[model samples]
Target: MRYLAHSAHAQLGSLWLSCVGWVLTAMALGLIQWRVWLVSDRGVISSGVAWVGVWRACFNSHALVTPGFRVMHCRSMSLAETFTPPEIVAAQVLMLLSLVLGLCGNAGGVYALRNIYFRTQEDSPVRLAFFTTGVLCLSAAVMSLVPLLWNLISVVTNQTIEFPPEFNMPPAPDSQHVGCGIGVGMVGTVLMMVSGIIFCTYRFPVRSQRPGGSSSPAPSVSHSRGAAVNDNPAFESHEDL
Candidate 1:
């Protein structure tokens, strides 16, 4: 029923990493700064800026109101709207799925760790629990990574999404750059992978015989020795007499 010598430490490490990763993933999903756009016009020194995310887009315009006055507007993305890009839809779906999986993994990991450290029950399926946790964490990592990478590629390629005229945003900005959300997502994905690998490494300790331990004679050998002594002439003579 014993596990590897370092199994306890490894399990604890995995639990912490998974928990942090889950929190980071949630933050990334909620943040609306996946891509940042910087806008500038000839007449205005500081014109406007916009940002887009999986769930929404926001705009900050200084020239629209008054000189040196900044106004910020945000719009919730709708799947029914034609302006919503396919990438945003995909990101939304995948990020949500990843968050859900991460939550499950964290719960399973806590249960497994509790059984390993607190409950000394030999019948507990700690190994299976660890394995399941690993699978869930890795799946979450993959799900989160796809959208993060896709959005990063789009940002690099200067992909644009058409904003409605009411939002008062340009179709394309003068320049665009990756935002904090993507960076956080990348870090979270990496932590998830590391935690999963550590969980998967948990294994039962192998039992090995000691070299200096005494060995007992086999039953067949003991029986043969007894028969030879009984058949000896000295014992037979006594029996016959």
Candidate 2:
């Protein structure tokens, strides 16, 4: 059976999109600006800004001992810490899981697309590969999306986290908003979903017409036997007898 070139092209496009989504997801997972806090008055805090992410939190503030100068201070987040919010901990776990699933999905997608483009395997194996890749990609998308939406809601509600004194940040800032990390994560999730749908929709094209601009039908066994009998002189003589 012959496959259509357009189908291969579509698979290639989805593969590229999925690869990009995987990279973006990793970026979002590592980014430390999931939520940004804007300080209107510098008198309260030296640098007038702070941000928190799944893995860490950062603040622009004066040092604990040297109060005269300010610097960007970042601290690693821990689930054991009381100041860390449950939402952040969940986000951290889910985002990491999403990254792992996305990696596997990208690898499987590449293998499937390569087989499809080269027509290396039977239809069944190729179709199965596509299905597996689609499932993985979609799963990854959902995993990443949960945390992103949850955090977005938290930001909308203006949720606050307790900060230690050494970091020199307020429990809540004067104003807060979503950060670039969420934006990037949202984009990546969208791409992953689109690619997965495309992968799932794959279908092998029907046999096409021959180069002579006509389709040749397969000859039946009964017709071939009848033609052979009619063409054989010995069979005709025996029939006459």
| Model 2 lDDT, residue 234, Cα | 100
Q: Which ten residues in a row have the lowest lDDT in candidate 2?
A: 61-70
Per-candidate Cα lDDT values, in order, are 0.82, 0.83
Report the Cα lDDT for candidate 2. Answer: 0.83
Worst 10 residues of 1 by lDDT: 61-70
List pairs with backbone clashes in candidate 2.
Answer: none
Predicted candidate 1 versus true structure: per-residue lDDT over 68-150, tens digit per residue: 43565567797788988887887888989999999999999988888877776563488889989999999999999998999
* Candidate 2, position 72, lDDT: 62
lDDT of 1: 0.82
